[model samples]
Every structure is written in C-alpha cells, then in structure tokens.
Target: MAVYTHLGSERLAELIASYDVGELVSAKGIAEGISNSNWLIETTGRDGTGARYVLTMYERRIDVTDLPFFLGLLDHLAAEGCAVPATIHDRDGAACREVEGKAVALIEFLPGVSPSEPSPAQAHSAGRALARVHLAGTRYPHTRQNPLTAENSAGILARFSESRLAGIDPDLPATAARASDIARQMLGGLPESIIHSDLFPDNVLMLGDEVSGLIDFYFAANGAMAYDLAVTHAAWAFDPRGETIDAAVGRALVAGYESVRPLSAEERAALPLLAQAGCLRFVASRTEDWFDTPGDALVRRKDPMEFARRLEFYRDAGQGAFA
Candidate 1:
C-alpha cells in the first residue's frame, strides 16, 4: 500500500461520514506496497468505543470493475472463518465508494503484527492458514483469473528494451526468457482454486506463532493451489535478499500446508517449476517497478534481483527445494 492521492482532513472526514462507522479521528498513510494508496483510519465508534479500519484507494494494477470480486472475497473468506478481514459496507451497503473518481474501500482492521523474520512455528501457522483459505473458497460463487502469471510476466518484460532490463542487471533478460519457456511448459491437470498469489511475510499478521489475519488480497485470484503454496514457500523460506533458502523453514511451511490440505502426487511433482514461476512473477513486477516508480513516490522500491537469485536457486535445486 502507498499514498498517491492525498485526501486532506476535511475530505477524509466527509468520506467517513458517508458510512455509519463513526466520525473520523485520524487517517495515517501507509507506505509499504506499490499498487495503491492506503491509510490506517481511526474513528469514534457509534457505541462510544474506539475502532480502526484500513482504507484502500484503488490506484494502479487494479481495475475498478474488479472491486466486487476483491472486496467480496474478503467478506466471503471472513464469513468462512478464514483469518481475513471483511469489507465494511457503507450505509448504502456499498462495498466501496468513489473518491476523486477512484474506488476506495473500508476494510475491517484486524489485530496482530506482520512478522519480519518469522519463526518455524510461525511459518507452520501461516501455511495452515493458507490451506484453510483454499478449502474455504471452494464454494465461493465468483471466479477471476490470475492476472500475474508467468506468461503475463514475460509479456510485461517484452515491452522493456534489453538495455533497460540490463540496466537492472546484465543477466535479467536471459533470466526472464528462461522463465517464459518454463511458464509455457508448466504442467496442466493441477488443482486450482482462489489463491492469495502474494503471501509475503508483510501480508501476514501473526501473534505468537498463530496467524491472526491475512491482509492485502488485491493479488488474490483463481489459480493453482500448489502454485500458491510455491509462492508462499518462495516468499517465507528465503533470506531478506532472497540469496539463500532456509531448509527448516521450507520444510515447516510445506508440512504446515499439507497438514491442513494434502498435496496430490501431481501437485508434488509440479512444485519445483511452480516455485520457479513464483520467483519469475516477482522478478517481472519488481523489474517494472524498479524502472517505472518515481524517485519520490511514497512507496518503497523492491529489488528485482532478489527474486532473480531465487529463480536461480529453484532451478538448481529442482524438486529437492520442496523435499
């Protein structure tokens, strides 16, 4: 979440007034992610209690028409007892409101802290939570395609000149090309479901090895469940720079996920390639963000090479990475 649009105090108060949530006490901008403007909203509750909510202004990378699918998924997941926050509908029962012609949502503020360096037990809990999400979403009525696939990544990279890509790193273009080839050959017949394609550590809130909440479902989509596990494994089992893998953490995460939902033999066989796809997806987006993001944007620029190294690791380790 980032702040591209700055709504002043009066505008924020007016926006809060549209809902019965209560009078706005404060709105603080969140500056972690790349896609949207987010704020931590605090308010005086209707019951004289204090309440907090996360307000997200749809910025880039999200289409306005997809609001229902995104926000509704949150409500659906929450209803199914997944550790996900719900969308707070306005007095008119709308899940989102338009602010300056952009769609904005008020999400239920859940408790817990995002783990920085997660423990093995925390990784286990997060895995279990993700598995639960896949199982719960089986009956969800709507379906949306995964937008950030390996092919999509390759296409995005194709638009960039080789020189521009090389500017990030000399080997980036070759790495991305290799990724595209693997993507085309990604195994079929794998199980698919609603997936939180982006389950990085920052997206998970944990308290004492238990997953308290899973936030930021913007990248959530209908996709391969094993691929989602691969994404989580690639995300959680790496060092900050993505230079090394923690085998213990990797084992714990896969163990935790399988504890809730066992992987099919086909899914197990596909993991190494799926993990590579996960890395490629990040490499593509981060490469774009690296060159495209403005110098003064409130969002932080992530290194594309971090995932490049990860892709290399997955390629060399093969299925042993999962084992």
Candidate 2:
C-alpha cells in the first residue's frame, strides 16, 4: 500500500529494459511496505528464461546519499554468506539508476512468506540471523550513523506534543522520559557495530521453520549491539496490548543470539533499560508520524500507544522483564 508515486506501463517497461536481467513480462505493486514504492517485477531472458525481481523506487524520508551504504551492505552480507536479498546490477554495471528523478534498484526476489504468527523456533532463528549479521557487518566498509540516540530522543521529546501522548496515557510522556534517562546512561556503554536497526518481524522472510532472508536495510546503522537485540525482542515478543512479552520466545531469541556472539556482562545488565529504549524510540517516531504525515500519503500510521504500553511493562517488571 506504499505506492505513492505511480508509474505508467511504458515507463515501467523502459526502466526494466535498462537492466540485463531480462525483458519485463509483468509488474505488480507490493503493498506491504511503508517506506518506499516497491514492485514485484517479472522478466524473461532472450532464451525464454524467466526470473523474478523487486524494483524499489526510493522515496522521501530516505536519504539519496545513504543508498550506497545500504545497497553495499547487502552485497557485503551476501558475500559473508548471510541470508540476505541480493541486489542485481543493471546492464551498465550499475547497482542503481535514476528514474523519474528517484533512485531505483533491482533486488533479487527472495521467495518465502513472512510469518504472521511466529513460533518460538522462528524467533530463535531471527535472533541467530541478527547476531550473524552483526558479526559480518563488522567487516563492512561503509558505516551509517545512528541518529536515534538517547540524547536526540530526549531533545525530541522536550518539544514533543504532550497532548498527543496524553491521548495514549496521561503519564506516558513521563514514562518515556524516565526510560530515555535510563537508556542515556547505559546504551552508550555497550559494544557498537553496524546493525540492521529495523529487524521487525515483517522484514524477516521465513521458508517454513527457517529464515530465508531479511529485507529492509534503509534503517541499518552503527549502534549498540544490545540495543539492536532489544529492538527485536520488543518487536517479536510483544502482544498487541503490550501487556506481556512471550517468555519462551524472548528466551529463545537471546539464547539463539548468544549461541553466535556471546553477550558481555554490560550488555546483559543493560537489557531492561535497552528494552525500554527500544519501546521509547518506536513511541517517539510513531507519535511524530501519527501527527506529521500528510493525511493523503499512501502510508499506514501505526498506533504509538502500543509502545507506550510496552514502556510501562518494562518499567513495572524491572530487571526480570525480558527474563
């Protein structure tokens, strides 16, 4: 449903022809993403060879300057044997092309369905993949700086629309401030690396019980490795009301991650605050989007209060929250 700028058929065909992958047979708009305009493109080779690929037209809110780092990380991770979608270079040996003044690229179509209701095993695999990605990302040359640090969050919240938060809960802003304080003190002390900062469930493609690939690297950046894990724990383990995180699934995630790269004592001790930081981040961003995004934009705004409830849960449970 994120098809903001629609293209004519003639234009689409011309763009596909720019690539050596094949001739364009059919193209369908993929409606699941919120960041960019994506199309599932089908092509055929000169010898009647058919192939599937995804064409992404980068939209606003995504920096054109950061495209190299994002796409380059995909190439790097694939080289490292990670389960990642590969980018297909065009005929002129270019990974990206300008179409209608927008940056566009063709990516190999990874086949699998993202689980609607993930099992414990699936959670474990996701964690395992994240850890492996962190390990591999160490060798990546380019770095994307994380702008969503605790200090920035505090500054954003200072000018935040307090009344909007009161709609979620009168005390939600206070809760966020406390969590931000905790995060500021601890998040900076953990191990840092370039991480897939947006590893939500929808980004994880599963082929049965195993992880097939992870999509969406636009949010990838250098950050605390534990904060990245905490982000996943918030995403994969929480229920709709955010009343509780699934104990078994959360344990599985941490366990699976530990199996790949062991967590330092600092990282482990910072888990609770880090979890709060994760929720605080989503709440802040979602709140901004909930109000700032134009009403006519072809995007869905998630409820910010869901993370508010999560922040409250972590605060109430304290150290044993994720345990």
TM-scores for every candidate against the unseen true structure: 0.92, 0.93
What does candidate 1 score in Cα RMSD to the true structure?
2.1
Q: Best by lDDT, which number?
A: 1
Q: 96-159, model 2: which lDDT tens digit per residue? A: 8999899998998898888877888999999999999999998998888898876666666666
- For every model shown, the clashing-pair count is 1, 1
lDDT of 2 at 132: 91
**Deviation (Å) of 281 in candidate 1:** 1.1
How does candidate 1 score on lDDT?
0.89
Question: Taking the tens digit of each residue's C-alpha lDDT, what string does model 1 give over 258-323?
Answer: 999999999998898999899999998898888888868866789888898889898999988877
Q: Report residue 201 deviation for candidate 2 (angstroms).
A: 0.6
Give the poorly placed runs of model 2, Cα more than 4 Å off: 293-300
Q: How good is model 1 by TM-score?
A: 0.92
State model 2's lDDT: 0.83
